[model samples]
Target: MKIFVARLQGTPVFDPAGDQIGRIRDVVVGLRLGHRPNVHGFVVEVQPRRRVFLPITRVRRIEAGAVIFTGRINMRRFEQRTTETLAIGEILDLTVRFDDQPMTVYDVAMEETRPSTWEITSVALYKGRRREPRIVDWGEVSGFDTLQKDQGAAGLIAAFESLRAADMASALHDLPSKRRIEIARALNDTRLADVLEELPPDDQIGILGTLEPERAADVLEEMGPDDAADLLHDLPEEQASELLALMEPGEAAPVRRLLTYPEDSAGGVMTSEPVILPPSATVAEALAHIRQQDLTPSVAAQVYVSRPPTETPTGTYLGVSHFQRLLREPPSTQLGTVLDPSIDPIRPQFTLLQVAYYLANYNLVAAPVVDELGRLVGAVTVDDVLDHMLPEDWRERADYRDE
Candidate 1:
């Protein structure tokens, strides 16, 4: 059997009991002085974001999207030796001389020569980014001197191109700190913002610290106001203030407002941005608004009906129009007609516990916050509440996948 190392990334690895242990993160290959590199094992990311080595001898089958294996995993974290190379992470993007032409390494194909033993047999090289890669004997390519030079993060990012923001963040977190910063620097502001929202506060601050203050502010602006506020809350007051000051006035306004309330208060946890619209907006308009690519699932599940002003601190709060209602009503039906205003809005001063009980009582995925004038200020999602309720390092904790 032949498996392309790049494709093995993120593949689920199952144990003898058919329970998934973890996902494949990278392939560990030991380079010899000459001949093809020996495939040692896989870097399997287990619980708690730990990457452990899985010897090829333990692997029983390599099928679509899954790697079935026998025996109990050691669970000890894997550390790369200087003599070892990561197939997907290190070798995939290396430039090599194949025949007389210089080509970019795109993938390394591992062939099972006999029994459970595997070896790197060939590599897929791209003449150019737009061209399809051609497979050539692994020995044909030169420059595997194993010299560890700083590689462009483009190759690393490309390997994670298919992942969602959360998945991408996990993949990145597994990388070395320097590499993580390198990749973060390569990502554009908007993309970086999305991934940062999924990462823990510490990781967010670490990567943000690497960027210039101006770029850091731009990334913050791209993030959800609530998320940006939460991240800033983690930084030193002076540093946070500097980044906020660098942000555009209009973009910084909402985040600044969010930061004023106590971290555990309703206003602090609520996102200043939600699918908000005037009462006159039609059901179809609400649906279209929620359909935006950037809207999170919880936020998109409902729309806020308000008076004239649509932005946060909107005109007198009307009620919430759940997406289900939008779907059931006529496209031209006004949101105000079917809006659910029976449930009272939470005040900015409400405690996290109070907000949680309110949502639970109303069976709400999200609840709106109102000020003294009854103006809709923001909406607090269940996710936001849970985030604050969980241990600060919950993201750094073990994955529940093993359970």
Candidate 2:
């Protein structure tokens, strides 16, 4: 038999003696891969504000608006296990994107594959009265299991794996602190680092506080130096020092450099990992480096050529080479021949407004930063600039738009 989750809610359950036992409050299921979860049990409201668990094995028949069971139902209150998922409470009425179009989930249809085991097969989506409601296969949707507060931390993490870090962070922000910490614990270092960078300062500090010092240090190492520095700046000085001490010296060094500048300064917002090559490097070598790092569009759009035996914090800044210019030149052509020395580098102490103006005036996606000795230090991307320019509560507003 097939039934919709919405219909199952509020339906009455009858005992073997044909006497009313309770009304169905929720249906519990366990999450699995590829296929829908198997129905585990039913949460039955025995009295006002009181609920009990009725195992699926005890159910004899599921009739219209009612359920018939053969055994005695336990009167003990339902205690949700970590593996259980409550369909009505967690899934139904949630927003999901189907075929890239936003819609609200009105109901979920479950199919009985065997005598008692059932799995969710499809979801009913509704946009508005002007459009006909659509039913889509369960696999064709995203954002269904997001914000599932009661599911186990591992299950919640798996459900959100496809989401971008920004989207995942927004979902995590809406959950209760305990559940949020649980989910944070389940994420790997790289994924956690990305999400942490997208979160607000208070949330970043709160989540980091939950992790062990060693794990927190590893996550900080995985983040962009500027972002890692910003997070550390908000922590107690002693605690921040401890985390830095736990990190690898090489990774920690860049973050330490960023911390020396004021929070609103160019050095504070610039990433220390931009592509830096010697002026003698060939166009092919620069292209290979960009491909190997898999840098983002803004960061990969240009390369800084400096006098170097060492590239990072290069010995001396020569100039910049735009990716477009590199592509136009012969593969073996030296970078020094193509360097754009006319573009001035911003100083570390430059304010946010000055950095923005520099980038805007040059029509560049990123602008290089240099120290007093004229050695290249870092590059500030447009995204980082916008992050500082936006209102403090922008992330909260972004979450609302997703719903």
Candidate 3:
């Protein structure tokens, strides 16, 4: 019997013994080249706030208010895989072309096609506001591969609203490239920039390539200079230069300087916008600056004391004042008075291992990058060093999916 996926959502799921285990969040369906999508499983929100994949094969039966399953269930967190779409999260409310006519999807239903195989069987579409949704066989509409281009990404973005940028990037990686591009287009510049930083180079370039040059430049501006440079480094020299030219002069300057260094060097991996302050600035003022919402924990770990110019490429590097030290000192005290002069800064040309060693040796989360003229150029965080040292595919590691 076909059941509307919308109704299954939030319904409690049970084990063969009738013990409540979780509530259904959505159904995972695998898109086929030219056929109805195969029902892969259900996304179940288990006790204590974990969501895991429950294969359809394990489900004993589906009822109006409950779903029962047999056998053991793995409790590993569910990570969306390639071609697996979330029916409730991604399909419902999507505006797609049905028979060359644009319509909003209201519901989708699935049924067991064989002893253990289930597939989405039909779709409910809105033909008119007052009329009951038009139910049509799923096969009548072209495969989602064809419909993906016409669908808006609002529903998909909503599904990812609660996910961190890294988790969201993982979900985006699992989508078909076309849909991924579509969703990327719909995200605001800052959100897209954060997600882009978490994505691999190939995916970053692909998404960046699809945006209009001006918007792409704006998105790049929102990304960390190191990340922006890294993305541009992978692009053709001409295209990279064009995008740089389109970015605001101040934003482009740091990235341009970063692009000149080898990708693995300390300068290349460092952020030019670390917390910097004049020697005369007070502890109270330094505390307020680091409190900015956008400051990453690594960047906020310490505030560097400098002379005259406080921005990157400042006059003279004084010393560092860690957040802990700031909290312990009197608020009115000058930053220079409390600075830890013993902490050494790394040079721009330090190798990745050298940079890692410097941070490790000092037991510091971030270290300033000093230039030949004794100017503070940038700062490299431990996370930045790890990002360079880890295997290229570290983000895609499958250990999280081990069941």
lDDT of each: 0.87, 0.81, 0.85
Q: Tens digit of lDDT per residue, candidate 2, span 93-192?
A: 4668999987777667788888877788888877744335588888887885566444335434645666667767765675557667877888999999
* Model with the higher lDDT, candidate 2 or 3: 3
RMSD in angstroms, candidate 3? 6.1
User: How many steric clashes does model 1 contain?
Assistant: 1
TM-score attained by model 3: 0.76
Kindly list the per-residue Cα lDDT of model 1 for residues 113-202, writing each as its tens digit: 888889999988887765488998988889877454565566667777777788788777766787788888999888899999989888
Greater TM-score among 1 and 2 belongs to 1
Compose the digit string of candidate 3's lDDT tens values, residues 1-403: 8888877766889998989998887799997876888999998876544577999999988877899999989987788886688897678657656788867677889999999799999998774444367888887765355444456665567556666687667667756687788889999999999999999888999999999999999999999999999899999999999999999999999999998889999999999999999989999999999999988999999999889788778989998999999999999999989989788888999999999888888898999999999999999999889988877866655443342
lDDT of 3 at 263: 93
Candidate 2 residue spans exceeding 4 A from truth: 1-151, 398-403
TM-score of each: 0.87, 0.65, 0.76
The lDDT, on a scale of 0 to 1, for candidate 3 is 0.85
Steric clashes per prediction? 1, 0, 0
- In model 3, what lDDT does residue 255 have? 96
User: Which sections of candidate 3 miss by over 4 Å?
Assistant: 1-26, 30-39, 43-53, 56-85, 88-93, 96-102, 106-148, 397-403
Which 10 consecutive residues of model 3 have the lowest summed lDDT?
394-403
